[model samples]
Each structure stands twice: as C-alpha cells, then as structure tokens.
Target: MFTFEAEFFPDLTKTSVSEFCGEELSVLLHTLRRNGQLIEQLWNLVEQNGAIKLYCIAPEEDALEPRHFNRYGLEALSAVLQKSVRPPVFRVIGKTVGLSDACACENSEYYVLFSNFAAEYSPVSCGDCNLPVPLYKLPGENEDEFYALRQWQGEYKACDSLFVLSGVGEKFGYREISEVDSSLTRDGCDVCREMSQKCNRPFYYFLHRHISPLETCPRCGQEWGLDEKLHGFYAFKCDHCRLLSDSP
Candidate 1:
C-alpha cells in the first residue's frame, strides 16, 4: 500500500470552504475505498493554515486515477474538490513498511480472500504468491468497484478484531476458528463461491484456528492436512468445503 497526502487549500475568494469537506468528504473517501481506488478511507483530516489536508492509503501509485473510480466516486470527488482553491494536490508520502509483494497472478490457479485484524487492505489474495489480489482484478457485476467484497472485508475485520480482543467475544472467536457453520464462515464461503463461479477457478475461505493442530478436517472429518504447508501458513485445506485453515 502507498501513502498519499492531499492538500485542499481553501479558496480565499470564497467566504468559507463548502460544508462538503466535513461529512461529505468523509463519505466520498470511503466510497473510493469501497471501489478499490484507495486502500482505506481518509486516515487523517486536518485543518490548519486555513486548509484541509487528508491522508490515505492506496493500493498502487495510480490507484487514485480517474480510471479507477466508479461513477459515484468520481462524481463525489469532483463535487468536493471543486470547493478547494485549486485541485487537491496529491503527493506520495511513503509506502506501507511491511507490505508483501503484490499478487502477480493474472491467471492464478486459485484465490483466497483472507484478512485479519492486522490487515486493513484487500482480503482477496492470489493463492500462488500469497500476496493481496486487488479487488478490481476480480470480475464483478459492478463496473469499476467490488463493493460486495469490500463489505465482506469490513465484516471479517470486525469479527477478527473482536476475536483478537478476546473475553466476551466467544461468538467471534468461534466464528474465526470454525471451518464451517459460523456466520462468518458462511458469509466467507458465499464470497468464495461467488468469486469461483465468476472466475472459473477455486476460491477458498481462510479460517484461522488458534487451538492445537489437528490431523483431520473439522468440517468433513476427513484427512485434509497438507503434506507441505501452503505458503508456509495454511496447514489444512479442504477442497470439498472450499476452506483453508492454519494450525497453531
């Protein structure tokens, strides 16, 4: 992920910056995020020296380009930026310190939508490189956005955060650990099925287990342990269930 800073200097000729910069700007930022144009919503919104500056993460250097935005996002951005003195000046500040190599699997044999509390970017990953697969790469009905995938990622992250927090989050912990049946597992499996059907490739739902290693698949009660760990992480994978899990 790349970090960028956008400075929106107030138009001195105008009495004040339009009200769009407040909540409307935030909505626009998230709209871009859901469209896969930005990695996350504006991380920082600061007002200083009569200017509003925003910081955010992007999947690529050209992620913010107009070509990447959905119709709604593009429109919202134009409406908000017009309120600035000039166009919002964008500059790359830095890259994510520990971002993995981006997925290069144009025709990956399979894909996995996997994310944890620590991961705030796209959950879909190429099975081959174990790197994030940009949401836009996957075929979707939406012209330029994978809003459904983004919504799933948000729900998954919320469940993961609760699981990580522990205590009084038994339901969340079980959801993460279970290979099937849990609401999270069901939702993730639905996403996997949809993607796989659309792409004509296997898409697996990664289930994280915090307990001891098991010799058999939890869902099917069959031998599913891989002879060699996949990506040195997934200890088990059930083709029938379209599920993968890491053993502690």
Candidate 2:
C-alpha cells in the first residue's frame, strides 16, 4: 500500500469516475477511465488526508537524521512523477506576500507538472502549505508492483528521498528521467503502434507496464529497456512474461 493511503485516507475520497472528473485534472481522469488497467486500479483507490499529515510516516529502517528527510524527499518523487507517469498541470491559489493579494497569474504558476502527478505551489493553505498529489491510487493486489518497488527501495526512507526534498540531485532526478523516457513512447516506433493498431496489422516490439523501466514488448515477448537504447534491438529478457529475444 502507498504509505500515503494507509496513513491519511480521509483527506482523499474514494473517487468514482464522475468524482474523478470533478477534480482539476479531468483530462487525465478521462484518459485513465479509457485504459482498463488504470481504471481497475483507481476503482478501489482512496485519497490522503490534510496537508500537515504529509510529515507522518511509518518507522524508518535507519535512524532519523534531520538532513536525511530534507535531502532525499521531493527530488526523487518529482523525478518519478514526471518521468514514469507524466500527469497534468495543476494550478494553486496564489498570494503575494506583503501585497495582500494573489500573485499575478502569468508569473506565479508552475505548470511544469502537467501530467499524471503534478507538483505546484500550494494555493490554499497558509504558512506550511503544500499539496502532495499522486495521480491515482492503486489498491489491493492491483497495487502489488508499486508496493514491491517501494519496499525494494527501502520503503519510508527511500520514498522520502525519492519524493521529498533531501538532496539537490534527487530533486530534479525525476524530471531528468522524464527526458530519458521520451524516447520509449509508441510514436518512436518506425511502424508506429497507433497507425498499425488502426490498420489491424502486426507491429514491432511494443511495451506494456509491468513496472518502471522494464516493460514487456507485446509483439516480441522481450523486455525493452526504458533507456536510450530500447528501440535499437530490445532483446532483453521479459520481466513480466520471462520470455527471451526480440526475434520474431
């Protein structure tokens, strides 16, 4: 389970499709609705409660140090959000500090997070204000891959490092990773899955999510790398199906 869910669920409603579309991120909500796996995951999802509760966590495996949290969080999670699951632009309520009014619209907004999981200035809260958002919550067996990955990364501490702000490098790593992933999308296919899917013809190695950076290529039964070299040959062993070779 995403610690966010187990910890502060009341802040998050168990959203329905209509409920989902009601949020600021309706476009992405609709996209998730059309995709079977995404829909199934969200069907049982819950939301977190309150802004302040973000500081709470399960016990860390290592002793807590002041800088540890300051160093690792935000850097890691931002990268994961932008690279792995590009969400959409979420606007925050803005205020100008001494001026007693909101900041001007054009200058204050940070639309950088315009995809699956967005991070932007917190518009609503006063003082210690932020909105921690995960694009969708996957629950039960549907959440297995995510929980396993979190555990493997060392759970709370890892999550803090990856998602919270502790280090300079980790802060933008997720965004950097987003650039690396741009190459792996279906549009890069020389034959292109979109055209072929419409044509009702076979296509080259395609991918579906098993987890990050390791996806099973539907046509070839091989695991394509998420790195720069994925399309070149992509003969890596399938993590999902355990199949070998890109040879068809």
Candidate 3:
C-alpha cells in the first residue's frame, strides 16, 4: 500500500470555503472511495502553514491517476481544488508494510468479506495468496465499476461493527451478516456472482461463523466441509452456493 498527500492552499480570502469544506471534502472522499481510487474512508485532513493537506492510503502508487476518476470524483476534486490558490499538488508520501503481502497470484480465486476488526481496505481478497485484490484490477464498466460490491462493503462493515459490540443489536447484526438466507448475505452473494462472471474466476462469498458445528451447507443442506481447511481458515466450502465458513 502507498500513502499519498494532496496539498491545497485554500484561498479563504478570495472564496471562503470554510462553509463548504467539510461537505465538499466528504463528497470528494466518498466519490474516490466508491471508484476504488481511495482505500477505506480513513483519511487525515490537516490545515497548517497556509496549506490544507489530505492524506490517504491507496493500493497502488498510481491509484489516484486522473484516468481512474469517475465523473463524480472528477467534479468533486475540481470543486475542492477551485478553492486553492495555485492549484493542488499530489505526491506519494510513503509505502505501508501490511500484515499480508500484496496479491501476486496469476490465477487465483477470490472471496468477498469485510470485518470491523480488520484494517483491510478491500472487501475482495485473493483466495490463493489471502491478499487483497484492488478493485481497479477487477473488470467493470466505467463510473459504475464495483458499485454494488463497494456498497456491500459499507453495509457489511456496519453490521460487523454492531455484532462486535455484542449488546442489544448483537443477535440482529449477526444474523443479518452471517446467515445465508439474510438480505445482506443474499446481496453479497449476488455481487460475488457478478464479479466471478466478469473476471472469469471463482468469487466466493464469506459467511462469518465463529464456531459453527454444521457439517452440511446451511443453504443447500449438503455436505460442504473440506478434508482440510482452505486458505488456513476456511474449513467449509460450498461450490454450489459459493459460500465459505470456518470450522466449529
């Protein structure tokens, strides 16, 4: 992963952006995030020394290239920079050494999941290397690329967070997130199918089961347990349902 900084000298004297700074900046960040140009919603907005700097983490050093911007991202970026005095300057601040190495497999399967406990930015990960697959590397139409998948990530994260709290919403959140027949799982499975067809590779939908004892597929009621675990964690796999869960 690469850390990048975009510095802007907002001329508050000419056009006061203080009123719209928060709103406009949020829109810009969301636009970039949805397009997969930016990883996660995590960022730093700092104002110092007569400059406003936005720091972000990206999967690739060139992930913020102009060509990567969808129409909305472009417009948002322009709006934010219009408040600047001498245009905006962007550069890679540094590289990040993460827990998992970047996906390097030539032919690898994929799984889709998001955990509130993990800092994994991408919801899609290579089944072979157990590393994230940057959304831009996947096939999709312009502007709407990975649109549904990205939406699912946000929704899943919310549910995941609630489940982690383990309070009043725990059962509700857990069922919504991990149950195969739940709306969230259904939507995520649909996204996996679409991504699989687009990339011509297996895209499995991860079902979070902390200590499931079921030997049969929850959806199909057929045996799906593997002789040994796949990817060191997934002990059950249902090809028909495109689902995976850990052992009991």
Candidate 4:
C-alpha cells in the first residue's frame, strides 16, 4: 500500500531553481516530496526516505490529464522495491495556481518531503527526458503559461528550513548547494500540442504507460510492437477499452 505519514516541504525561492531544467525539475520534485510513500529499506538508510517524486506543471487554472511518460518514475521505483533497493521517496508536484516567483504563493509557505539515497546505493540518473509533457489548457488557457530555465540562488540554501522537524525528518547534510537548472515546463506534452496547433510546448504521455521503444500507445489499443506502430498517438487510458483513451 502507498502511504505518506510525513509533513513539510522545502523553500523554493531561497533555494531557487537551477540553470538546467532537469536539475530544476529534480529540485522541484525534491520539494513536492512532502507527503508520499517511501521504500522500506531506503527508508532505513537515508536521513529521510520514501518514494521518489513525480511532477506536472500547467496553468494553475487547468486540470491535468495523466500520461504514459509519467509511468517511468513509478516503474523505476517498483523495480527498486522488487530488488529491495530501499524505501524510495515520492515527490509529486502539481501546479494548481502559479504566482510570480516563490512569492507567487505569497507569505504562505509550500512544503514537500525530502530523503537521501541508501549508503550502499547508486545515484539513479533520471533518464533522457525527451518526451513532451501535456500542458493543461483548460482554465488558464488565456494566461499563456510561461517557461524559463531557473536555478537556486547562491549563498542562500535555506530550503532545508521547510522540513527540519525533529522526529519527522532530518537534513541530507550534503552541502550548502545552490541553483538547480529547471525547465518552467507548461503543457509540454504531445496531446496538448495537437490541440493547440503546434503553438506550445512538446507533447508527453497522458496517464502514461511504459512502452518499450517496441510497445504501443495503451490508449489506442495499439499493439504497435505486436502488429503496428502507434503513429497517430492518443491521450489517457481505458484498459477495458483495450489500449484506447477517452481524451479530448
């Protein structure tokens, strides 16, 4: 069962975003890791441990449709658990209503769970994030969700203050690190692109399914590897529908 019995998140402004989108996204995932699951073994090794994070960004007003690309995080964790890598952490970040910068949320602080890798573990590199992410254009379609490459600030790594509870958690104690390159990704997924007439970010899997380069788009009931190639992709899933989706 997936359970999160923790409280807290990190400070995004002080720690800020990094220069690269991948690192920034990781840091974002780091903060959103507030209340999620963790693997049992990894849980024992890190100062704080649990499931890894999964994130999706969009106009605060838009509602998100799941994707296939999103499956990797969980699949990787499931593998770790099967191999007993350790209790992993999950940092799921969603943008409901974005403001300008960290103050965008005002004095109201945000939070996420944080954890460390096991002592006998290897750093798992988030693989090639080349797939597109779906932009939620439902509510904030008029706002024009923006994008940028961000990083954490220098000399001010006070992000740890958000989750420094005594028994609840402990700091990773790595370094006064600063800046993590993050992509201000908004509706970068494919399904969103098709609807927007190619005027937006890249497209990604909605309610993602792990398709080997050989697998098919689950929504399309497409057994591309088995018989065809999912040339005309689709959105969400309906296993009952036999690899088809109900996406708009």
Tens-digit lDDT track of model 3 for 21-49: 57666787888887766877668888777
Assess candidate 1 and give its lDDT.
0.75
Query: Which model, 1 or 4, shows the larger lDDT?
Result: 1
Clashing pairs in 1: none
Ten-residue segment with the worst summed lDDT in candidate 3?
111-120
* lDDT (0 to 1) per candidate: 0.75, 0.26, 0.76, 0.24
Q: Write the per-residue lDDT of candidate 4 for residues 1-248, one digit (tens) a residue.
A: 12222222223332322221234333323222211111212221111222223333222221111221133334443433343333433333433242211112211111111112221111111112212112221112322222210011110123233223323322221121111111111211222333234333222222212221324453354543323223233333223322222222
- List candidate 1 stretches off by more than 4 Å: 9-15, 48-50, 99-101, 143-147, 219-221
lDDT of 3 at 139: 55
Candidate 3, 225: how far from true, in Å? 1.9
lDDT for position 208 in model 4: 17
TM-score of 2: 0.16
Candidate 4 structure lDDT: 0.24
Q: Candidates ranked by TM-score, best first? A: 1, 3, 4, 2
CA lDDT, candidate 3, residue 231: 69
Best by lDDT: 3
